[model samples]
Target: MKLKNNVLVTADWLKSHLNEPFVKVVDATYFMPGTPRDALSEWKGKRIPSAEFFDYDTRICDKPSSLPHMLPSADTFSKEVGLLGIRNEDTVIVYDTAGIFSSPRVWWMFKVMGHENVFVLDGGLPAWEHANGEIDTSEPTRVEPTNYQATFDQTRVIDKSQLLEGINNGTVNVIDVRPNERFLGLVPEPREGVRSGHMPNAVNLPFAQLLEAGKFKSAETLKMLIESALSDSKRNVASCGSGVTACILAIAAEYASGDVVTVYDGSWTEWGSDHELPIVSGK
Candidate 1:
């Protein structure tokens, strides 16, 4: 499938192409700390016709780590995605209950795993519903498993060592995507005993600022928002409460500047928990 732009697609465009062959739709809805909705159960209950559930939390990550939803190994990623009936040549569209939150994480995962044909459904499920598009509560048609090759791009992801180096060397701009209170260390972290406050030398650009209602803002507006966060340095890395929403900021940064963005897979969940890492509070 030919995509107009690689990063995102509109609801109308996706609706028109729903029946196209080799097009796989993934329901990637995820909730935050206090939300009552269970993402997997909700996807099982109702989703777009022929859409499969991509459990963002389970599909990726170092399970041993206490941090939530970290990136998985390339081999693990390939196996899991292959089991979902995804092929290298397929045009994958990911959508979530929230317009532009969890879907981009899946989109980024595909990119990090070396699949370039994936995209996030702009405005997500709500946008589709608003357009009066058809939805199916029934289980989707399953295709035979296909071979998926993952060529992991290590540069697109940041680890603890790299994060520390970036901060000390001032080589990359670390942008925290948590809420102001969380970033400022004024509020207790949702995860138990994790230290509050932002990473040293990191700037705060809460993920919420990048969205309007249930959708992403205009490209120009997004660019401007990110521009204000940067000083003289050009390199950018994004982090959030966990690893999930950070991908949303990374997607926005990519759209805004067309620059390569890195995600701190462990993010605050790992950073805040470690007593050895330095932390600072307030603006």
Candidate 2:
């Protein structure tokens, strides 16, 4: 509760020091494939005061890959954030429109890029508005660019090759955070030409279970759920439909066990699409 590793920040704490120097609020909102809401449009209408938009779907991804929002190179990350005037010393609070949804992806992105001070705004924008927090309808303030630098931490990310090897050998806990239907191959995938099932040795632990009314459960609850699912496996690699929701598992794993954790950047988008990767249907 006392700002654990800068993983989360309360709305009250954020508002109290809202205008402090080196504090940067980021709106890291992104909807699913068929959602009616547009995150950028909503940001233009109402958002936390002085917050900047971090477009995870488009600008922050690997543009060359056909997969959705694959992690971009460290150089690209530096250039993209530098234009937003973010510096190494800044304390970043990232939030999403759907409370605890997509913001964790941004937090994971920052951490994998070697930014340790990044945190998620607990309960996101709704919590802010509920507390009578200020919302800026006008365009966010523009700032002079900073010379941002990123030191990529390979250990924080799980590449597809590593995942495949781990799955074959059963050395790592490959956890799929998709819904039960999708995990069991009872429903079709949203993307075309992709397989219906999950990785061979993967376990399904939907990200929704870790939340209650759009907020994370207590640390004790999270630790229990994660440990029960993982058994004795200490190393965890998370994946979901397109790598967005997988980060929720990554955050929960680290917050609970403080163990070695990584997220598969391409997730099922890459695995289910490739014909060579082994996948099985039903549980």
Candidate 3:
């Protein structure tokens, strides 16, 4: 089923518009720390035509931060995205090799940077291959850099302090998108030095529940799943391992309920490592 929200575009739609001047395709794939597959290497081997790799981990992130892929400054984002030949008016389509994995994070990043025309390519590269979309293995042609402006939207993200205040004050519903095993401290975190268990009062949603066969479920299904976890009056905060998968929840929330989710950018990486913060395990 097609995504009800305008935030996503199907592979078929992208295949037809691949050569459009106003449409800019981006490969935003990312692999976890222990994964053997390298996203950049895989992209180099095979990717959609005219696609530029957006390196969220290294090139487009806050370099000084200890956290992984923390959001870069507005100026940095504008500069880096402009270097990719993306203009403010272009219809940006982002996708990952792992279907829906890191694409939403890139899409959310664009939104956070005040780019409204950005959309995630539903089902990603796999779907494109399925649709017989043209694949380009040759080196990406360098395009002239365009002027791009970015206005950072602080309301889209929440820091540790703001999250704590919201959780303590009961003003926000903290939705943890990690697997239940990780959420309940049943398994050790992949990252060292970080503790298991979830934030106090955070509910486990498990990002997979929002997807079916690596693609987002229908809007009705998403709405049912999201509404089950959130309260009507409280704001929503999406959190996950190192703040990446949290964007899936953020997109799901917006797609389902039209409620914008304020992502906890530091997420478990920051909260779990700090001994002072409270963590709860087991239902």
Candidate 4:
């Protein structure tokens, strides 16, 4: 489960390595509610040659959860990924239609499942098309399922109870990657019924501040920016609307050489909606 030194790959690098036997490309596009786009249909229409569609919403989540797209059981994840023709040793490259959006979640998911060779496509599919890389509408090749089993990395993810305990004991810092307005409670949450503020004592990073047109800042720049917010404390739990954008912070933190980083799997959607949870406004 050891990861590469770098978790990002440029479009040029991926295009050149398309023919590598161990590579598996994944389209991990996901849109929030009220954003009108059918991810599955779009992938079926056109995608990077040899890329498979990872339906983050449907085929690979905790189906019984009232919350959106929570993590599935390790066995469930292993089986679904196995059905996608993924093997434990394969190198995974995940991208979303929106540059860098939602792709990091899949990358994080892979890492949590103990597959660390995965990388996010820098600037995502748009970067590939801009680079004039190959695009295909050909039917995806179906492959026989592989025997896949996942070893969950407990240190990479945190549940609601752990988050509450950490917050209460002041043993961990929480970072919310939501936009400034949402983090400050100036705007309503995109998900209806959810409150508009951040967790008590959580700091705001606004996920976008670490990117430029969907590409990440250099590791040095990222480290400096994060350090400016964190000062000296490094132990952190990341969260956002649902659980997706939280991983963006986790990935950025790792690239910045920060430690004690883990994602809150049920993020703001779960926290904000619970009236009993202590939430504060106006950072």
Please, what is the TM-score per model? Answer: 0.95, 0.95, 0.96, 0.95
Name the 10 consecutive residues with the lowest summed lDDT in model 2. 1-10
Model 3: pairs clashing at backbone N, Cα or C within 3 Å: none
- Model 4: lDDT of residue 253: 81
Candidate No. with top lDDT: 3
lDDT of 1: 0.85
Model 4 stretches with alpha carbons more than 4 Å out: 1-4, 231-234, 258-260
* RMSD in order of candidates: 1.5, 1.8, 2.2, 1.7
Off by over 4 Å in 2: 1-6, 231-234
Query: What is candidate 3's lDDT per residue for 124-205, written digit by digit as tens?
Result: 9988888899999987678889999999999899999888888789898899999999999999998999999998888999
Residue 126 lDDT (model 2): 88
lDDT of 4 at 241: 91
Better of 2 and 3 by lDDT: 3
Ranking by lDDT: 3, 4, 2, 1
For candidate 4, the 10 contiguous residues with the lowest summed lDDT are 226-235
Candidate 3 total steric clashes: 0
For residues 1-283, what per-residue lDDT tens digits would candidate 4 score against the true structure? 3345678889998988888888889999998887788998899888999888898788799999999999999999999999988899998999999998899999999999999689899899899999999999877778778898899999999998888988898877888899989999999988889999999989999889889987899999898878755625545888999899889888888778845369999999999989988999996
**Among all candidates shown, the one with the greatest TM-score:** 3
